[model samples]
Target chain A: MVKITYISHAGEARLVEAASGQSAMEAAVHHNIAGIDGDCGGVIACGTCHVHVDGTWTDRLAPPGEKERDMLAYIDNARPNSRLCCQIVLGEELDGLVLHLPIAQH
Target chain B: MDIAVSDIERARSIPLDKIDVSAPDLYLRDAAHPYFARLRNEAPVHYCRESLYGPYWSVTKFNDIVEIDTNHKVFSSDASVGSFVLDDTTLNPVEGGIYLPNFLGMDPPKHDIHRQTVSPIVAPQNLANLEGLIRQRTRGVLDGLPVGVPFNWVDRVSIELTTMMLATLFDFPFDERRKLTRWSDVVTTRPGDGVVDSWEQRNQELYECAAYFQRLWAERAAAAPRPDLISMLAHSPAMRTMSPEEFLGTLALLIVGGNDTTRNSMSGGVLAHHLFPAEWSRVKADRALIPNMVSEIIRWQTPIAHMRRTALADFEFRGQHIRKGDKVVMWYLSGNRDDSVIDRPFDFVADRPRARHHLSFGFGIHRCLGNRLAELQLRILWEEVFERFSAIEVVGTPVRIPSNLVRGYADLPVVVHA
Candidate 1:
């Protein structure tokens, strides 16, 4: 299991232990994390699963793909550190990942 | 049961290659289910050589529809090349038909910019602000209804609530709100479905709609920016300079997008509850199920039956050879019922898991902008409904609209028992 920290827009933080192969979205959804909707079931189609990766860990993750970038471009609160967590697969390499939820899912 | 059996029999009798699911009458009779079921079973990527709208390919399965919807690069919704509906004439006018160009029909870059301009109005913050008002209005409407007597739910409740919501969105004159309803109907209805007699008449009515909005636009434009859609469009640099046709198109899109889709779903929930009383009872017994039930209702209604896209270039999709410019209609109605994706696809399960995952809101960039707002409206409507009435019985046969484009009702005679 990989440990990840999810900080809400209100600064409330929750730590979850996600299986290595699953995406951050899958884990958050599995844990019934309040903010992440994962409405498209990890297809990167709906922008509902948007999150901001911690600056410290942002460099560890690969940049979003073309489809992910296009979907993110339309998100209301997207920023340079923004990513659709569905694209972020949990692994031993990113065991102590920190992510921030948006004000709300569009 | 007789209708279902006959529909299946008729659907089975037709040759696989000859089945055309675009006929308006099929939806009018609510008999399109068996035909779509056959398509999903036999030819998920089925093609019809001809129909009132002309030859088009129907993507019936849920995954196939998702694939096509997300791949906007290959399957374009640009109105110039074609349109987002099987009838291209609506966007590309011929003689009597009007040219209505809006963001929904445009491709990326342009579609992205224009869509972003007004999307904030339905953003979560704005929705939170509007929730109390929506709930209050819903209560008002519900309190006014005559209980234990059959009335057209479509007119009395669905139309009334949705129209009032649209009026609030535009800050449209409250008394004149029904005009928004009329304009929405005009935008979707073709000649002689009872809304208008001919395309010329439809055009005339639409121009009146345009004029009415233009008057509002002039006022809103001259004033400081406000929260209403008209004010936002007037103030936004990206939208203010839209062409007259584009202005009308944008208004039509917003009006219908905000109006008809939710209206049908409100009526649909009543119908679904009537058909599936057990599920309704489950919801009433637990108010927490309201949100999930809203999603179920939208899926069951599949308010906007199909969305069409034109292939940008020749491509092989799901092993079928689709040429450039071929009209591809993603049948959301069929996709929502695909048993492979949805367990017991026909039954309305209020607490169904992953209820938010459905095709009612088309996938990708052109997905419905007012989705959350629509959900808020339905949620409020049902919550208020439960507080007032123990049951809403379908007292008479529901008369469905005869259009493949809009799977809706003309009348649903219902009686609310208090």
Candidate 2:
């Protein structure tokens, strides 16, 4: 399991152990973490799975996909770190990762 | 100089020409193009003058139709005006019995009130409140999909997501979730010979659910304040005193909208990717473009093809005179592909800068009440698609819907490789 942290817009820090190979969305959701909603079952169809990554991790991860990026643009509170958790696949190499949850998701 | 004859001049007061182009009963799935072009240029608002519905005006141009749909006061949605979907001789006896109330069918004060009833439930806070639960719900559906198997993605995923979401919103029993979805599909799966068979039995379906909702409302109304749709409808300012019939109408609207609209979008999103594998690659390489792609996909595949309106008063638009009480069909399938507005209107662009401007959600006072929900569902869906499936290569030819009013695929088979 990889150690994943979620930072809410209010800056509340919550840490959870996410399974290796599971998307960051699964980790936040598996731990019942607040603020990440993969509403379309990771089909990248619903924007509810939005989360922002730390600047450090944001650059390290693969950029958001065309569909993901397009969706983020429509998000009400998108940010530079804005990432759909479902798009972030967890792996052993990246044991330490952080995502910031927006205050709301439309 | 010769002027075209008014369909009314031929014989029927209501004109029979519209049947060829606007019949909701007849399937126009693979209609020839020259006829459409003629409809577009020669008679943008001319009566079909041939097929089932007869002589009803077909609004073919982009801005022209949008203008009409936006001004709901002048163009009434009352079924008395005309049922939004067309009707044709192809309809059989059983086709006459099935019924459903989509929000698109309601007009004005009633429409406004019905929409407002659940407006708060879809508010940003409400979505935020359900974030964790939604994520869990999505994960559960994904987990249930049979891996390494080529199943109907539309059934397994698209319908499944929205069905569960509807159940959660209503706080219905999870066991009965699929039932609601099935009933909803029967109501709005587009008119077809195959679908027509099942739709014949849909009234019984509605009556059955009406009883269930009646009981749920009673139980929930007695309980403490809650956030589910049932609780909201019980205490909502706009809906608290609604008659049982009106309540059922709104409930049916929510279910139909929540089910069919998003499912079409889900299937469309995948189809766009397959049709344009390069953009799919760009998405695979850089996922941030998913949102833009979603909007473009909606634009590309206008799931809800056209909404019919009845002229309340005599009005002339674009030099064409329309009579009061005339049936006017808003051809959105044509509008979305309008050349004047969207460049290369036929091609799917992943990073379209003005994707949101598309009129799929419609425009004006009666615009889509669930636009936000549809977008939310799609955003999450793309995120998931980017996560689980490496690609969605079409495995077989998709079966497009036959109804002129609903432009979508009845079945889209795709191979999903992990």
Candidate 3:
């Protein structure tokens, strides 16, 4: 199991343990975490599952692909650290990653 | 048997150049599969030099479609280039203009604001509130079906339920609900193809519809805020001051959006079960799979076959030089069958893991607003169906709608076995 923290738009941080193969978006969706809509089910579409990766952990993860970046560009409140959580596949390396959710996904 | 084999062989031998899946007659016969298959294999981004809607490019592969749908800079949904379909003809005085002022045809900040204004109607909390009403209505419609006899499922179940939902959303008179369906058909149908005698007639009918809705708008505007879509629009700052033309256009958008997508899916789901009994059996055996099954059905059916977007500027896509103001048709029907992303794209699997990941609801900012609501309606419908009927058997060949868009049945003769 891999542990990750999701900070909601409301500034509340919640930690959960997700399996190695599951994505951070899936974990949030499965647990009904606030603000991670994941409406497209992680297809790199909709861009509803956006999250701001903590500055410290940003270097640890691989950079988003062109498609993911394109979707990120359309999202509101997209920051330099913003990444679609659906694209962030959970693994042992991401065990302690932290993500912050935006106020509105639309 | 020998003749059937030869027919299949003959279908296979037809050259890719001879195949044009855009013809409505193919869909009328429910025979677009082989054409799309050949196109996907031979040319993912196939071009048709001449057709009814004139020259247009077909993007078949899954990845290519996503690339086009996401990159709105080069490829645009703006009304100036062309409306969201191949046919740019409109009865309005302005040639090659979008007849409606809906956000679906607009780009950027304008689209964002209008879409945001109406987004609350299908928000999660609102859907949760609507769950009970949808289930109740589904039960009513199912319980009233004619059992053990051939009945038009399209009319009896699909159209009835969807029209009811549309009326509720618009706060239109429930008794005159069929008018909503008629207006939706008028808005989407190609004039003089039997839906209406001519564009003049279609415009008259649409004007009648606008007059009716205008009255509703007047009533809603005077009353306090309400949850219905008309009231929502009446109360909205951005939409409240829309001109009559803009009002009619927005109404067309909401009416068609609320009508066709789910109505056709309802009929398509029944037809799918008939074509693939094994998948139906899997769904029947485990009701837990209903949610995923709903997504799979939408993907397989793809109620709306394609959405056309015109190029705003010249851009190279999938090795094709798409020039400025070119009509590019993203065949959702073709992309849903793309083998690269979806395993065994031909087969209908109820519990496919990536079920919700389909191109039916489109992608990006303009994805179907009522997607979750459509899913909820289908899920509750199946649950209620399972409790009441043993099976919904298709007794005769369904008469599919003869259109490149709205890939659905016109008359599905079905018999329920309780």
Candidate 4:
């Protein structure tokens, strides 16, 4: 199980374990994590499941694709590290990824 | 079964040219006909030849709408596809002209900038701030209805709550709030080309409304400062440089977004109580079920139905090639009812633990900014509706919007068992 930690905008940190190959959002969603809507159902349509990947682990993950980047540009909490978790399929390379969530998913 | 691609393609879009707008059973129900369900089952990405908006794909089924919503670059929400619904009027191709007066009609980057100006004000904190006012206003609106009498709840409750909320957001006089309501309806109404309130009427109202806002801005800019959304926009650095068109557009977005979506949900809630008395009893028995009840109503109503999206590039969904600039309508109303995702998609179950899963607020960056507010309004209105009158019943049939985009009611005659 790959444990993914999330620090909410209010600084509360929670942990979820993804069965390797599940997206971080899918893991968070199955456990009923707050603030991760994934309204488009793991599709990149809605930016509700956005998160900030830790800078240290940025290089480990694939860069946001053109579609993801264009979508991210419209998100409420879009930062330099912003990524739609739906776009990130969980795998072995990402063993312990830490993501920060926006105060709310718009 | 063969796909209806040929028929859909030949028409360019769903043609509503001969739509029976006045037919009782025709305009009402989830879909216009069994044809829609057939399209959903057979060709989820079927196109129709609409009287307005021209040839566009009617994305039925739950999963596909979510798919299109997820891939924004492929299914863009720019102005080209026509923002509202397909009508003889909405299809009138304007020359390099952007339709509607809000940011909902724009593409990504530009939508981002305008969305930012007022986004902060609708955040959780702000919603929390407005909760008290919302409850008071909601109660007042409900109180106005004659308890134990049967009348159109949509008119008395839904429209009232929407107008009152808009008044709170704009911090404007309640009496004039109806003007914003009227203008929003006029703007979003999808009639044939140059139909409804003529462009002359729209332009005149737009100018007057903008001038009113400008005057309010100057007064607020000079007088005692406050913390309303309008003041926030007036003092916003980004708004300071916005062109008149952008200003009008953003304001129109806020007005329409805050108004129509919530009103439909409000009416939907009442209609839900009438349609499924069992669900009503479930909530009434356990008052704590109000929150989930609000969500269920939103899901069932799908206030904002299919949003118009223009394809930015060539793409394919389920093996059908979609060329660049093709109009794609992501019908959230159909997607919210996706059977695979939501158990008993058609049933109104308040206790569905995941009651909040509905795409009523839309998805992604364009999700309803005032969703929390909309929920708050519904929550309070239901609490009051249930509290003030216990055994309410629908004495007559419910009326729905004539347009395609707003899947809600014009009126729902209900008897409040006071």
Please provide, for model 3 over B241-312, each residue's C-alpha lDDT reduced to its tens digit, 9 standing for 90 to 100: 888877888888888888888999998888888778897778888999998899999999999899888888
lDDT of 4 by residue, A9-103 (tens): 88889887889888887888897788887766666766778898887877788898876776787666578888999877888778778899887
Identify the superior model by DockQ, candidate 2 or candidate 3: 3
What is the alpha-carbon lDDT of model 3 when measured against the actual structure? 0.82
Clashes of 3: 0
Error of 3 at B166 (Å): 1.0
Residue range A12-65, candidate 3, lDDT tens digits? 999999999899999998887967767566777788798889978987888999
Off by over 4 Å in 3: A6-23, A26-43, A48-83, A87-95, A98-106, B1-18, B90-98
Q: Compare the candidates by TM-score and give the number of the best one.
A: 1
By lDDT, the better pick of 1 and 2 is 1
Model 4 chain B — which ten-residue stretch has the worst lDDT?
Answer: B17-26
DockQ of each: 0.77, 0.06, 0.29, 0.42
Highest lDDT against the true fold, candidate: 1
Model 2 chain B lowest lDDT segment of ten? B1-10
List runs of model 4 lying over 4 Å from the truth: A4-18, A50-68, A77-102, B1-25, B28-33, B50-53, B80-101, B190-203, B221-226, B312-315, B319-325
lDDT per residue for candidate 1 within B159-203, as digits (tens), equals 999999899999999999999999999888788677888988999
Rank list by DockQ: 1, 4, 3, 2
Candidate 1 stretches with Cα past 4 Å from truth are B1-4
lDDT of 1 by residue, A19-106 (tens): 9999999999999999999988999889999999998798889889999999998898789999999999888999999999999998
- Is 1 or 3 the stronger prediction by lDDT? 1
Ranking by TM-score: 1, 3, 4, 2
RMSD of each: 1.1, 13.5, 4.2, 5.4
TM-score computed on alpha carbons, candidate 2 = 0.71
